[model samples]
Target: MENNEILLKPAMSFAVLKILPLIFLALLFLLLAWYLSPFFVFFSIGTLAAGWYRLLYIRKSIYLVTPEVVRISRGIFFKRTDMLEIYRVKDYVITQSFILQLLGLMNLTLKSTDAENPVIWMVGIPESDVIDTIRDYVQEARKHNRIYEIN
Candidate 1:
């Protein structure tokens, strides 16, 4: 694929903590329904369905990092593909919340020159090595594309 050589293909998964609130709410509903009636089973099932749906969406997300560009394809029904030229990536930040840190997950936020989608976030990357690889690729791409900034 020449310039389209795939540098890193990272999976986008939702952290367990991110979905904890949904599970908690589902349990709460189940408890409340326990006192009311057996109809609460429906709410429990609905909660499970919602959680599964969210997971399915994340599973469907695609993140491809190449020397020339970064691509993200997301959404289930109405799919979307966002591309950011590697040369236009201004800076990137790797962040991990307390829960994410505990789970060994990280979020990579890339700030690019693209005005429409200046900020691109790739979350739930399972390893720190992926972050380092992305950083190196972005730097290499910038050099390859002769991108420079003067402060």
Candidate 2:
């Protein structure tokens, strides 16, 4: 209800974090301006465009928990909102690629036990630690069978 009562965690963006190369390339282009090659301008523009997309993609990557379910929401192009009852969860998986592992990020997949539809996956979680946090929340929700409130 109140901002003070909510856990406002940091929103991590792979775009922002992974922009080191773009920044370097932009700088390199500027530094090598004397040469004035078309490639330099192209690279510089490309880097800026990428950085711009990433910046717009930024959001409050967060999952809010209540007494019933877990509500996870995030995205840049397609805003996602997942609401799953803790009891319906059949399996929980956490995966990290080589690049993600190096960057300390992970993807979380939640499988529900329902017959027709049963799988939900969230990508680019920005931090590997969210797996633990989400797992712990699931456990607690299961213990009490709580429902989540979605915004």
Best by lDDT: 1
**Which run of 10 residues does model 1 get worst, by summed lDDT?**
6-15
- Residues 43-139 of candidate 1: C-alpha lDDT, one tens digit per residue: 9889878887777677776778876778899888899998888778777788988866766777788898899789998877765566556677777
Residue 134 in candidate 1 has what lDDT? 65
lDDT of 1: 0.74
How many residue pairs collide in each prediction?
0, 6
**Which candidate number would show the highest TM-score if scored against the true structure?**
1
Each prediction's whole-model lDDT (CA): 0.74, 0.63
User: Residue 92 lDDT in model 2?
Assistant: 79
Compared with the true structure, what per-residue lDDT tens digits does model 2 show for residues 94-142? 8878877787776777788656448866555656455555566667766
Alpha-carbon runs more than 4 Å astray in model 2:
1-15, 28-34, 55-59, 76-78, 95-107, 114-151
> For model 2, what is the error of residue 135's alpha carbon versus the real structure, in angstroms, after optimal superposition?
5.1
For every model shown, what is its TM-score relative to the native structure? 0.80, 0.52
Worst 10 residues of 2 by lDDT: 2-11
